[model samples]
Target: MKPRLAPYLFVTPAMTLLLAFGVLPILVALLVSLTDMNLGGLADYSRVSFVGADNYRELFGDAAFWQALGNTGVFAVLGVPAVIVVSLVIALLLDRGDSRLFRALRAFYFVPAITGIVAVSLVWGYLYNTQFGLFNHLLSLVGVAPVQWLGDPVLVKFSVALVAVWRGTGLNVIIFLAALQGIPREYREAAAIDGASELRTTVSIVVPLLRFAIFFVAITTIIAWLQFFDEPFVLTKGGPLGASTSISLFLYQKGFSASQFGYASAGTVVLFAIIAVVTLVQLRARRIDAED
Candidate 1:
C-alpha cells in the first residue's frame, strides 16, 4: 500500500465497525420510528405500516416522556458538575504526592468505575433502604428522622444522581490524575518563585493547562449522563412513580415492557438529536476558546 493510503487502510476495520454498529443502528431506528411496528409487526411483516410523524407528535404530547426527559436533564445537570469537581479535587490531592499510599489510593478510588453496575446497585440499594439501611442508621444517630432516599419523588432524583456521581467520578479522577502528572514540575516551581500561594498557583498555572482534559471529561460525562440507565434500572427500576426514570429507562420501558418499539425508536431519535446538538455546541465553544 502507498504511504498516503496506509492510514486509511489501518482505520478500515474501526470505520467498518462504526458504520455497521453505530451509523447503521441510527438509520435503522429512524426508519423504525416512521412506522407503526410492534411485537405483532415483528411476527408478521404485513402488519407493520408507516405512521409518518404520528409517533413523533404523540411523543411530544406525552407527559411521561417529558418527565423522563426532565429527569435526564436533572441527572446531567447534577452529575456533570459534581463528577468533574469531585474527581478533579481528588486527582489534585492525589497528585500532590508520589508515595505508594497515594498510588494505592488512586487505584482504590477507581474501584467504583470498573465495578459492575449490578454490584454497585445492589450495595447502594441496601444503603438507600428506608428502614434498615446504613444511611438511615447514620441519620438516627444525629437525631434526624429516617429519610426515604429513593421513595420521595423529589428526593429520588438527587438520590439516584448521587449514586451515579459517585460511580462516575472514579474514572474521571484517573483521567485528571494522568493529565496532572503530564504538567511540568517547572511551572509549579516558577509559580512558587513568584510568591504565588498554593491555591493561586493551582488556579492560574495547573488548571489552565488541564483545560483540554477537563473539556474531554466534560464531553464524556455529559454523554454518559444523557444516556443514564444502569443505576436506575438496577436500583430503583424507575420506581416510586417514575421519579427516577431517565430517557433511556423510559425507552426501555416503552420498547420492552409495553412493546411500543416504534414509539421508543422515535424517542431514541429525539435523544440522538439532543445529544448531537449539545455536543456540537460544546465543540464550537471549545474551538472558539482555542482560537482566542
Candidate 2:
C-alpha cells in the first residue's frame, strides 16, 4: 500500500464520523437559528420563515434568558474551582496513603461519578427534604433550625451547586490522582535535599509539574458547569421561581417544551459563543502565566 493511502485509510472512518456527527449538526443548527422554525414548520417546509437575527435580538430582552445565564455563570465560577481544589486535595492525600486500603478508597470515591445523575439527584432530593431528610435531621440534633435547602432562592443556588460538586469531584479526583502518581519521586527528593519544606515542595515542584492536568481539568469543568442541566432539572426543575435555572435547561424548555426550535438554536449559538470566549480567555491567561 502507498504511504499516503495507508494514512488516509487509518483516519477515514474517524474523520467521516467527526464531520457527520459534529460539524453537520453545527451547520444545521446555524442555518436553523436564522429562521423562525417551530412545530408548524416541522409539518410543512414552507412554514419556516427567515427571521434573520430576530431570535438573537429577542434574547437580549428576555428576562428568563438573562436569569438562566446568571445561574449558569454562578455554577461555573463556583463549582469549577471547588471541584478542582477538592479533587486535587483528595488526590494528594490518596497519593500519600499508598496502600491497599487507599486503593479501595480511591474506587469508593469514584462511585458517584459512575452513578446516573437521576439516581444521585433522587438520593440528594430526599436528603434535602424538609420533613424526613437526613441533613435536616442532623441539624435538628445540633439544635439548629431546619433551613430550606431547595425552597429559598439563596439556598437553592447552593443546594444544587453542592450536588454538582459531589458528582463532579470524582472524575477530577481520578485525573489528579493519576497525575500525582506520574510525577517523578526524584524531583521531591531533590527538593528535600535543597531544604525545601513539604508545602514549599508542593508549591514549587508538584503544582508546576501537574500544570497540564490541572489546565485540562479546569477547562473541562468550566465547560461542564456552563452546560449544567441534569442536576438542577432533576432536583428542582429550575424551580422555586427559576433560582437554579441554567442555560442548558432553559434551552431545553425553549426547544422541547415550547417547540421554539429557531429561538433555542439562537440560544445555542449564544451559548457556543460564551463557551468559546471563556475557554479562549482561560487559554490566554494560561499563556500569560507561562510567559511570566
Candidate 3:
C-alpha cells in the first residue's frame, strides 16, 4: 500500500460510519420535516401530507419553543462559565499536590460525571424536597426561611443549572488537570527565580499556556449546555410551567409525548443550524487569535 493512501484508508471505515449514521439521519429528518408525518401517518403513508415549510413557520410562532430556547440559552450562559471556572480552579488546586490523597481526590471529583443520571436526580430530589430536605434543614439552622429550590419558577432555573454544573465539571476538571500537568517544571521554576508570586505565576504564565485546553473545554462545554437535558428530564421533567425545559427536552416532548415528529424534526434542524453557526464563529475567532 502507498504511504500517501494509508491515512485515508485508515479513516475510510469511520468516515463511512459517520456518513451512514450521522449525515443520513440528518437528511432524512430534513425530508420528514417538510411533511406532516405523525403516528397515524406512520401507519399510512397516504395520510401523510406534504406541508413544506409549515412546521418551520409554526415552530417560529410556538411560545413553548421560544420558552425552551430561552431556557436553553440561560442554561448555556450559566453553565459554560461556571463549568470552565470551577473545573479550572479545582484542577489547579489538585495539580499542586502529588500525593496519593490528591490522586484519590481527583478520581472522587470525577465520580459524578460517570454516575447514573437517575441516581443523581433521585439524590438531588431528596435534597431539594420542600419539607424534609437537607438544604432547607441547613437553612433553618441559620434562621433563614426555607426557600423553594425547585418549586419557585425563577429559582428553578438556577437550581437545575446548579445540578448540571456539578455533573458537567468532573470531566472538564480531569481535562484541565491533564493540561496543567503537561506544563514543564522549568516554567514555574523560572517564574520563581524571577520573584513572581504564585498568584502572578498562575495568572500570567499557567493560564495563558493552557489556552488550547481552555478553548477545547469551552467549545465542548458550550455544546453540552446547549443540548442540556438529563438533569431537567430526570429531576423536573421540564417542570413547574416548563421552567427547566431545554431545547433537547422540548424536542423530545414534542416528538415522543405528542408524536409530532415532523414538527420536532423542524426544531431539530433549527438546533443543528444554531450549533453549527455558534461553532463556526468560535473557530473563526480562534483562527484570528492564532494569526495575531
Leading candidate by lDDT: 1
- Give the TM-score ranking, best first: 1, 3, 2
Off by over 4 Å in 2: 290-292
Question: In model 3, how large is the Cα lDDT of residue 161?
Answer: 96
lDDT of 3 by residue, 1-292 (tens): 9999999999999999999999999999999999999989899999999999999999999999999999999999998999999999999999999899999999999999999998999999999998999999999999999989998888999999999999999999999999998999899999999999999999999999999999999999998888898988998899889999999999999999999999999999999899989999999999998898
The regions of model 3 sitting more than 4 angstroms off are none
Report the Cα lDDT for candidate 2.
0.93
Q: Candidate 3 has what TM-score?
A: 0.98
Better of 1 and 2 by TM-score: 1
User: Worst 10-residue stretch by lDDT in candidate 3?
Assistant: 231-240
Q: Local distance difference test, per candidate?
A: 0.95, 0.93, 0.95
Clashing pairs in 2: none
Candidate 2 per-residue lDDT, tens place, 1-292, comes to: 9887998999999999999998898888889999999999999989999999999999888999999999998888789889999999888888887789999989988999999988898899899999889999999998999988999997899899999999999999999988998999999999999999988999889989999899999999999999999898999999889999999999999999999999999999899889899999999989998898
- Displacement of residue 155 (Cα, Å) in model 1 is 0.6
Residue pairs that clash (backbone atoms under 3 angstroms), model 3: none
